[model samples]
Target: MTSSGIARPAGGAARAVTRTLSDDPLGGTVRRTVLPSGLRVLTEAIPAMRSVSFGIWVAVGSRDETGPQAGAAHFLEHLLFKGTNKRGALEISSEIEAVGGETNAFTTKEYTCYYARVLDEDLPLAIDVMCDLVADSVLAAPDVETERGVILEEIAMHDDEPGDEVHDLFARAVYGDHPLGRLISGTEETVTPMTRRQIQSFYRRRYTAPQIVIAAAGNLDHAAVVKLVRQALRGTPLDTDPAAPAPHRSATPAVRTRPAATVVEPKETEQAHVILGCPGIDRLDERRFALGVLNNVLGGGMSSRLFQEIREQRGLAYSVYSYASQYADSGLFAVYAGCAPGKVDEVLDLTRAELARVAATGITEAELARGKGMSKGSFVLGLEDTGSRMSRLAKGELLYGNLMPVDELLARVDAVTLDDVNALAADLLGRPMSLAVVGPFDESAFAAR
Candidate 1:
């Protein structure tokens, strides 16, 4: 829906290449137009394939939920499919399936998206159906009552999984009371109180045309897609503009209390699930590429420090990995491991030791080069899928404000020197780490280093 503020493009070499200026033709080829009512349209043509994927991204999520309205965005996503003016849930499913296509939707902290993939000839129908779901979901009384229980059960299910609990724990320690840490599904107390009127008010106030972004990929023509979007969203009342989000302030470092007083089950699960992390870079940070390379060396793949030490050498756990999940303004760099109940201490010690080792000594050239190769390879591999390509485009729109070509991304990875990776590790993972362990382990094990 807007320009993807992607960096300059690069050459066709599989290895990362530095660029003088971007060689991207897609920058010029991408077209943007706005309707009288405030709907923004963005289009690009991918001539290599015969299929088309039309996406509608709305800028409201659980983070946008006001007091007592948590999980409203996710609940609203389910209700959208239950019924609309033109079709009921069953009919909608049958219609899309008859044409050998598929439809789905997802909810996140910043957006809700409904997308469909179909043959190019069915692009108009796909657009119509998606727009209807967004602008016209019938939050019927019975459906609301029905979905409340479903969401409640979903919340309960997450509570039973140690990995899931530790994730929430890490978010709580990092974000404190900020909306960024709020659970998407919400608690029973908050979601049970939601009413049909509340859902309607939120939908009307936030789902405006100006805040909606439609991204399509595949063999669709640019002009035809522009026409289809313009026609489908013509009559909806685009009467409101979203209020600007609050400025983000980094959360003060906190040592969280364990789940001792709160009710929790799964105390006897065989493997312990640990989510140890620290606050890292934001999505818009220029050094995000360096952080990516750092993560790869630490625990990103099979050869990573955490994996090789915890799993391969000691045989303490079946799975161990490190990752970074960056959002609009901040991010989390974490190490997750599933270990034998008796070996939780060993796994935790190894993880912390590896983090400290990297911070103190930094990485060698071989480690940096290998990490760069892995990061660049993963980037290229992700581009092969149509859904991933569409997702990458949407991420660029929402984050950097432009779609970064694969070539440019590779170059950035290539440019990350050993010094860059070491600096990032020292900046992010070198401090006292926030710990979240979910299992039959004692909190004393996490007493600060």
Candidate 2:
């Protein structure tokens, strides 16, 4: 409740409040408005852009699901578009498409977003359709069963993709049975048995006004956007008693992880998928910038140490990279390689050597500079579109509870020193790591390797 986000009463009626959060010469002006219903609307008005991306972001994801409600969040996302009191499923899609626009939704480990990208002139239409689907969904029984079959098939298709499945295996290896380790799409056991009533209850209980944010970017007026959102949500579940937006997810009690263990899934695949990693810092960690620099040097790109040594020099693997995934209180840093079955050990050895070398002696000054450039260039380039800009606004509020200026973000990266990267490497890369492999090997095959 006491955070950098919009301050409001924890209970009772909250008055509508608006403020200009930022004014950039090139990025347009960013503004925020918190409605009496506790629904927060944020916008970045880039008049030169002919497209506007509107989204309704909920602060709920697979991480918030109970065991019985494993995939409930994602399932609910699909059913919302099935129908609402005001429009049917076809109407929802047809209306948006009719205007040369596109609308879609996705669920993540920490949040869910339902969004539409339309011509600037059709901003009002985008707001209404997006608002209607989120606020007034009628989760019919028939629709639940239909989507059930679709999701099961999706799960099956995912299983066939060993490349993707390896990441899930690594998550399980790290978090054990924690919700963070579970798949965003609940498995068949959970989805097949899920009932309409159960999902409906989950929806009403979780999607509260205080837990939602509406974000838009592109050519539009912030005030007009807020008004359209209010009108669209006039008589719905979200238009209830007002309260302060819920604080960012609590990070007090850190998420516990499993001991270092190697898990091998023996499947007869052409190439083996492998990930070697250990627990990393959380999103709030002060050393996150250092970690970013280290990750880039380690395996973030083609010129990265791992890529240069493994793929370019020996040609043992076609794909090799390292990444870090951060959550509210816990995170992961891992290296992935897809190689021929016979080359798995060599690949692992090379990867391990690179990690140990970096851990023992930090990267050179040249590597650090290149890493910084890559980090900064990628970030600035990613925001070239309205959707990315809109996402930045929602994530700032839902995840961090404050919009950090672009300059500040760049400065943070710029401030990372050689010692900072080296210190983080010595600490993080030196930690015990777990191994996950999806390949033609027995369970005992990887215990020693």
Candidate 3:
């Protein structure tokens, strides 16, 4: 689809093919090009703005690790910034900061992203610095040792926060020994004993061209961005052969039956954080739109059922919400509440009752309309910034292998009817739940109740 002087080309080996994915009057034109190196570069051009968000997405994460390799993906994320072949860590940070920009990276269950935001004029610098970090990190022994302590401290920091710790505990309770259950930052037990050799091996094996996508948005030209990327990635041994890109490695851990179980972590805290959830659909499930609407109506906002019932009407908790976490093949649907330690049982009962109510009777037409509107507004308002748009493009390519325009995505959300929500709720929320609680109590405290 050609618009605004950008021509679309058919896919080929010798030449990069450009295609427009979307032409939203509010979000600007989205485009993508597959370079000969097997690296996919996606961009959303918004000439109305002056800043750009650029990101390098790698299709590997904690789930890709072996038992002994736990936390290696996260470790490599830190090391990449320590020093590349051309610049040291301080230079990498100062160069971006000098231009009043931000640079950072994060690791998720299924992917890792290194990203930067800079003035549009500084786009080339951003691209060069990020590509260098991805393709030419030294991963020196001394730097590895230093970052190891930093990662361990991060793990410690996470443990000290009970509210955040409970989510990881909840994942463990839900998925058991599966890699999906492990923490992205890993534990002190895992990080403290890791070796540099293990980390370097992970970087070499997982950070390949075929598994990488470079996404950028905001005031930029698609051709210019592609040229900058091509230059930045030159001399790297990226596979450019005629064969199709390498298939992503799968972490197909066996699925286990959902059991009604609870894991209590005794911490000396005034408030308890608990998560109650059941199995959910995978990332590519068609019912995800219905599930999204259901989540919003159930507890996504302050106006949601859980918030209105537990917070506004009963005053049982301070923070309460429901969420869905989707992976490549599996997912979790959960509700979290932070309340007084003494009120744990009351909160759980209320949450369970609400879930049962939704499953049995479904939602009203008013709730369905509100859910769709909220989901649509959130999706559109979120993309007003370049970072969110860049993230959208990257995820669309890495996860789904196509870019879904804003209008098309909204259409899917709008298509969900009350019947769709009821069917999904009945199927997902009716399953047995696994509970996790972090508070000043033991397992017997819950069992006695």
Candidate 4:
């Protein structure tokens, strides 16, 4: 019932609340506790920093939606910003921005997060505003209509951006026709017909105590955070587990086809946008580190193979590279390029060959070492920011049940071997490729090429 206690969660699902209580010497210790109502509080104190960032993470997103409620999770995210009984949308914005702080929310396939960042003394205020947004949004009709238009425009913007469009297309090509294939923002047609009642129903079901994670980092006390979470979450009851949907069945791999050198809409833009992708491993896969290293050597940065081959060696494109994106259940490893329209085929062939070469030849010791070094350096650099640390902890709590200390993750990254990268390249990038392209060309040219 209090901040420090040991109680077994019914059905053994409550172990996430049980963590060693110790002072985190690098900054502040991470502490976990469960409220009587079942909410989980995760707090990390970084006294060296002057600002605090805390987030309320709900373990639900697009993957949870059924056919009719395809975009309801994202819809609820917008409605939460509309207003609460005590504050309107404008008031909420003014209040947060007034403090020289920032507030925002995002919806993904597996989670919806609302967070705020402010000076240390303003932690309470940030917490209060986030609590209001998450648990008390009014979802008024006027605001609903207004936000619908805003979301529609957001969708249009993404559709018009070739790079963004290619990523979406890649997801479809990789995941098949499952819910994962659709964009997180949903289509305009889907958003247009959504109603307030639908948003409320989805919100009430998914935003429950047991499923929520409250994480804070910066100058703060763990006990104070536990108190705020307990008070704010007092009467919310947990929803019974929803029936698990049938597994998303992917269609048989499509034949490898050259991406159509075409633009969906001809634009008077100076540069042509392009994206290439391959099916990737899931988040929990052991090969994640290898894939990350592969991405680093292939297209992660200036030193990556894709950059060297596509830009530095050939001077064919201004930008070109590869990276990996993983979700709760699956992933996509992709390469992207922006070049002159005339250079489309040349760039595509170069990218494809680079991918194929890595798969066949495997990475050398120097290449693997640099990839690991880059991955390690980026991970360490990310921790230098309080906000990034806070996010890392919050997401880790949601995904791994406990935070893997920075050292533990880096050690794993360091342990990756050349053999690992080779197998990863073969399993993921080397196989039959699925193509997605957008530019001033036609599908036939890609198929024929």
- The most accurate candidate by lDDT is 2
The digit string of per-residue lDDT tens for model 3 on 159-249 reads: 8999999999998898877888899987787888889888888888888877888999999999999999988878764544422334444
lDDT of 4: 0.75
Error at 14, model 4, angstroms: 12
* Structural similarity to truth (TM-score) of each candidate: 0.87, 0.97, 0.94, 0.88
Better of 3 and 4 by TM-score: 3
Q: Please tell me which model should have the higher lDDT, number 1 or number 2.
A: 2
Query: In candidate 1, what are the lDDT values of residues 1-449, reduced to their tens digit?
Result: 23222222365222111111222443324454444344545555567767777788777787788758888898888888888777788877777788898999999887888888888788888888887777777778998988888888888998887777777767776776677777888788888898999988888887876567677777766667777776676565542332222222223332232221212223667778877787777777788888888888889899988888888888888889988877766677889898887787778778888898898889889989889999888887876645665666555554455566666778888888888888878878775567666777566545533
Clashes of 2: 0
What order do candidates take by TM-score, descending? Answer: 2, 3, 4, 1
Per residue, candidate 2 scores C-alpha lDDT tens digits across 250-286 of: 8879999999989888899999999999999999899
Better of 1 and 3 by TM-score: 3
Better of 2 and 4 by lDDT: 2
lDDT of 4 by residue, 1-449 (tens): 12333355567543324454445455478777655445567777787889888898888888678767778888889888888877888888899899999999899887888989999998888887888778777789888888899889988988778767777776777665577777788788788998888888888877776577778888888888776655554442332232221222222342223332222334555677777776676676788888888889989999888888888888988878887877655677788898998898888888888788887888899999999999999988887877887788767767755567767788899899888889888777766666666666656656664
Of candidate 1, the 10-residue stretch with the lowest lDDT total is 12-21
Collision pairs in model 3: none
Segments in model 2 whose C-alpha atoms lie over 4 Å from true places? 1-14
Ranked by lDDT from best down, the candidates are: 2, 3, 4, 1
The global Cα lDDT (0 to 1) of model 2 is 0.92
How many clashes (backbone atoms < 3 Å, residues ≥3 apart in a chain or on different chains) does model 4 have? Answer: 6
Assess each prediction's global lDDT (C-alpha) against the native. Answer: 0.72, 0.92, 0.88, 0.75
